[model samples]
Target: MWHIYQFPLCPFSRKVRLLMAEKGIAYELQSARPWEGEDRFFAMNPAGCTPVIKDPDRNIVLSDSRAICEYFEETVDRNPQISGTAQQRAEIRRLVAMFDENFFRDVSGPLLHERMKKRLVLRQSPDAKALREAMKLAHDYLDYVDWLIDNRPWLAGSTMSLADLTAAAQISVADYLGGIDWTTHEQARAWYLVMKSRPSFQPLLSERMEVIQPPSHYAEVDA
Candidate 1:
């Protein structure tokens, strides 16, 4: 059995979920919120990050989200291939790393830590400066995305890969939080619209937060 410890809102967790769905893999989903400080979770992963996977057969515990995705790509042979050629695989890894490092820090981090922090923690006020900075960073990131999509059909290359999934997960969360302005980035927005319509993407669209509601357009796959 494959068991995944994850937080629903985490982009990293979302990427694994998407990959699982795309591969038609049936895994057990265990909600493990690192923010709540679970001892066993920390023992499994010292970093206490979400999206930790335990494979019973291998008796292996996978901590990092990217590592888990790569593990799946290598170990599983079902569905559309995510890691294509050597060059394609390298590009996917590069793009995934880029999204995880630069995009997450610049776009998703501040938006979640600032604008949505108050929602998650009552009595806290939104950080206007952080939100402004995140918005600027998101815009800058979109420019890079524009360049990517303009050149290639997908973020890494012609074929859809984990790179697209990683980027989509981040953008989807930002969209849920109303941190993205679609009109400003038409190319990226159009690419996202197509991704949001996929069967693997539906679960994420239907995700509802107890304390926060997504914009109407969020659930609209065509949007």
Candidate 2:
């Protein structure tokens, strides 16, 4: 069986989960908190990150979300290939990086760490100034997304790819924190609604962290 170590709220973990589901790959999910530095998990990945997948069938383990996804693209042959031609795939990679790196660093990391992580792990109050800045960044990023998807069928191009999954992963967490105001961006909201309604995304929408309740509209596709 494929074993996946993950954190429920982690975007990287969510990205892997969505990809696996999209590919119809079955795996057992094990929740892990890398921040606490668990010994066995650290052994699997010294970098100490969630979303590590151990494919017992192949007798190999992998770390890093992008590496794992790329490995899947290279090894797994399935319908609706996630990666396209070399040049198209490069654009997809670029957009994925935009979300995973730029969006995460500027918006998801700061806002989530302040609003969710600090309260859950550190047992401290959120830094209001940090949250304000993160929220500002989030709005700017949302406007960019609106423009990017204004014409294309997906974030990267005509087909749905890792770029869409990456952005969705981050947006899911933001929605959980009641951070996204979807009404402001009509095209982005339309795109997100389609994403949210997918079977792969349903389980993620239903996940509720202990002591933290998502907004009423979180799992509602039409909302």
Candidate 3:
């Protein structure tokens, strides 16, 4: 069986988990906290990140959400997340990059680092300045998401792709931290409602950390 080492609220981990669930692939979920920098985990992934998968059957170990998702996209054909023509696939990749890199750097990454990881895992005081900067940047990021879904059916194009999964993963984590203002971004909220309603996303919504409780509306897509 495939085994994926992940943190319950990690966006990168959620991305891979959502993609696997969407494809109807079954795997064992091995929880890990990369921040501890354990020796065993380091042997698996020197970079010390969650969302690393070990495929015993295939004799392969994979790290990095993008690389893992692309590997699955190529090997598993049951449900293609990157489906479409060449140009459409390119667009999907572009948006996925935006969420995983740009949006992450400017918004979710800092927020999660300050509000969630610092308090819960690192046992350090939250950085107020970083949190404030993240909150402000998140507004602009959500506005862009709102604009993207204004016309298109999905973030990248007509169909759901890695872009949507990546986006929802990041946004869901932020929402869990009470960082999102859903009422202010109507289109983005609508899009997220659909994403949240999917069976693939149900598990993520149900996840709760012992150290931190999510907001009341965290699991409510309708809210």
Best by lDDT: 3
lDDT of 3 by residue, 79-114 (tens): 899989999999999988988898788888887888
Worst 10 residues of 3 by lDDT: 174-183
Which stretches of candidate 1 lie above 4 Å from their native place?
56-59, 121-123
> Candidate 2 residues 45-84, lDDT tens each?
9899888999787889999999999888777777443667
Clashes within 3 Å, all models in order: 0, 0, 0
Give lDDT tens digits, candidate 1, residues 82-193.
6678888787888888888888898887776765656675458877788878777888878888889999998988878888899999888887878888777888988888
In candidate 3, stretches whose alpha carbon ends up further than 4 angstroms from where it belongs are none
Runs in model 2 with CA error above 4 Å?
none
Candidate 3: residue pairs that collide:
none
What TM-scores do the predictions have?
A: 0.92, 0.95, 0.95
Q: On lDDT, who's better, 2 or 3?
A: 3
lDDT ranking of the models: 3, 2, 1
Q: How far is each candidate from the true structure, as Cα RMSD in Å? A: 1.8, 1.3, 1.3
Model 1 gets an lDDT of 0.83
Report lDDT (Cα) of residue 65, candidate 2: 96
